[model samples]
Target: MRVLHGLEEIFAAKGSLLGTSDWVTVDQARIDAFAGATGDHQWIHVDPERAAAGPFGATIAHGYLTLSLLPMFMVAVYRVEGARMAVNYGLNKVRFVTPVRVGSRLRGSTELVDAQPLDGATAQLVFRTTVEIEGAERPACVAETVSRQYFGD
Candidate 1:
C-alpha cells in the first residue's frame, strides 16, 4: 500500500499512479452471497451447472459484483493520513470489459486522474480504476470513481 503523509500529499498526487490491490477470488460462495444481497440470482451468476453448458462455460460473477469490490480492494491501494474522512462521491463511467468467471482472481490498478480542492481542507479526487482478472489480457471492469476527502483541521 502507498501511504501518503497528508491530504496535501494526496492533492499533489494528481494524475499519478496510486497503487494496485491484492488479488481477490470470485468464488461461488461470494457470488451466491452477492446474489442474496442484491437479489440478482441470475442463472449466469449463481447457477454453475447450468452455466457450464451455457456461454463462458462456467458461472460468471455479476458485473455489479465486480464493481462492488472496489471499496474493499481500495483498502490495500492507498491512504492519506490526517484526512478526517473520505466518501464516495460518484462514478463517472463504468464498463464491464470482460466477464469474471467463478474462481477467478481479480485485482485493482488505480491511478489518480484528477484532483481539485473543494474547500481549504477538502478535495475532490478522481481515480481511474481498472479491475484486472488474473491471467487475462483484458480487464474485467474499468471505472472512473470520484471521491471527497476531508482533511483534518
Candidate 2:
C-alpha cells in the first residue's frame, strides 16, 4: 500500500497509479447478502439455479455491488496519513463494462486523477478506479470516485 504523507504528497501524486488491491472473490453468499441488504434480488444476481439458464450461465454480482467495493479496494490501495478524516464525496462516471460472476476473483486498480485543495485544510481528490475480474479481458467496472480529506491530523 502507498501512504501519502500529507496533502502535498497527495496532490503531487496526481495522474499516477496509487496502488492495486488484493483479489476478492465474488461468491453466492456475498451476492445473496447484498441482495438482502439492498432488496435487489434479481435472478441474475441472487438465484444461481435460475441464472444458470440465463445470460452468463451463472449468478453474477450486481453492478452497484461491484461499485460498492471501491472503499474496500481503496483500503488496500493507499492512504493519506496526515488526513484527519476522509469522506466519499461522490462518483462522477461509472460503467459496468463486464459482469462479475460468482466465484470470480476481483481487484481494483486506483489512480490519482486530480486533487484540489479546499478550505478548512481539506483536499478533494479524484480517483479513476477500475475493478478487474480475474482472467477477464474487460474490467467489471470503471468509475470516477471523489473523496474529501481533511489534512493535518
Candidate 3:
C-alpha cells in the first residue's frame, strides 16, 4: 500500500504508479447481488445457464459492476492522510475494454496521473486505473477518476 503523508506528498507522487490491489473474484453470487441491487437482470450477467450457450461460455459481469469496484481498488492501492475529508468528484474517460466473465479474478492497478491545488484547503486529484483480469491479455476496464481532498487549516 502507498501512503501519502500530506497533500504535498500526494502532489509529489503524481505521474507514478500508486499500487495494485489484491485480486477479487467475480462470482455468480456477487453478480446476482449486483443484478438485484441495480435491477439489471440481463441474461449475460445473471443467467448462467442461458449465458453458457449465448456467448463467452459463461455469464459475464455488467460493465458498470466492474466499474463500481473502483473505491475498493483505491482503498487497497493507497491513502492520503491528514485530509479532513475526501469525496469522489466524478469519472472522466472510462472504457470497458474487455468483458469480465464470472469466476474471473480481477484487480486494479492505479497511477497518480495528476494532482492540483484547488485552494488553500482543497486539492483535486486524478488517477488513471486499469482493472486487469487474471491471466488475460487485455484489461477489463480503464478509467480516469477524479477526487477532491479537503484539508484543515
Candidate 4:
C-alpha cells in the first residue's frame, strides 16, 4: 500500500496501481440482502429459479451493488493519512461490463487516476476501479470514483 503524507505529495506522484482486495464471494443471500436494503428486488437479481431460466442462466447481482463495494475494496488497498475527514464526492464514470453470478469470487484493483487541489487543505482524488470476477474474461464493474480528503488544521 502506498502512503501519502499530504495532498501535494499525492499530486506529485504518478499514478500507481494500489493493490487488489481479497476476493469476496457474491452469494444469493448477499444479493437478496442488497435487494432488500435498496428496494431493488428485480427478478434477475432476486429470483434464483426464474433467473436460471432467464438470460444469464442464474441470478446476478445488481450493478449498483457491485459499484457500492468500492469503499470496501479501497480499505484493502491503501490508507490515507493526515486527513481529518474523507468524503465520497461522486463517480465520474461507471460501467457494468459483465454480470456477477451467485457464488462468484470478486475483487477490485485501484489506480490513482488523478489527484488535484480542490481548495485549502482539501484535494480531490479520482480512482479508476476495476471489479474483476474470477475466471471471467470481462470485469464485473468499472468505475471512476471521486473522493475529497481534507487535512487536519
Model 2, 1-153: lDDT tens per residue? 999998789889999999999999989999999999999988899878899999899999999999999999989989888788999899999999999999999999999999999975999999999999999999999999999999763
lDDT of 2 at 47: 78
Worst 10 residues of 4 by lDDT: 5-14
Using lDDT as the measure, the top candidate is 3
TM-score of each: 0.96, 0.97, 0.98, 0.95
Write model 4 residue lDDT over 1-153, tens digit each, in one string. Answer: 667778777786548888899899999999999999999999999998999999899999999999988899988887888999999999999999999999999999999899988787999999999999999999999999999999968
Pairs with backbone N, CA or C atoms under 3 Å apart (clashes), candidate 3: none
TM-score of 2: 0.97
Candidate 3 or 1, higher lDDT: 3
Residue ranges of candidate 3 with Cα displaced over 4 Å: none
Clashing pairs in 2: none
Cα deviation of 96 in candidate 3 (Å)?
0.3
Best by TM-score: 3
Query: How well is each residue in 11-49 modelled by candidate 1, as lDDT tens digits?
Result: 689889889998999999999999999999989998889
Number of clashes in model 2? 0
On TM-score, the stronger of 3 and 4 is: 3
Candidate with more favorable, higher lDDT: 1 or 2: 2
Error of 1 at 95 (Å): 0.5
lDDT pick, better of 2 and 3: 3
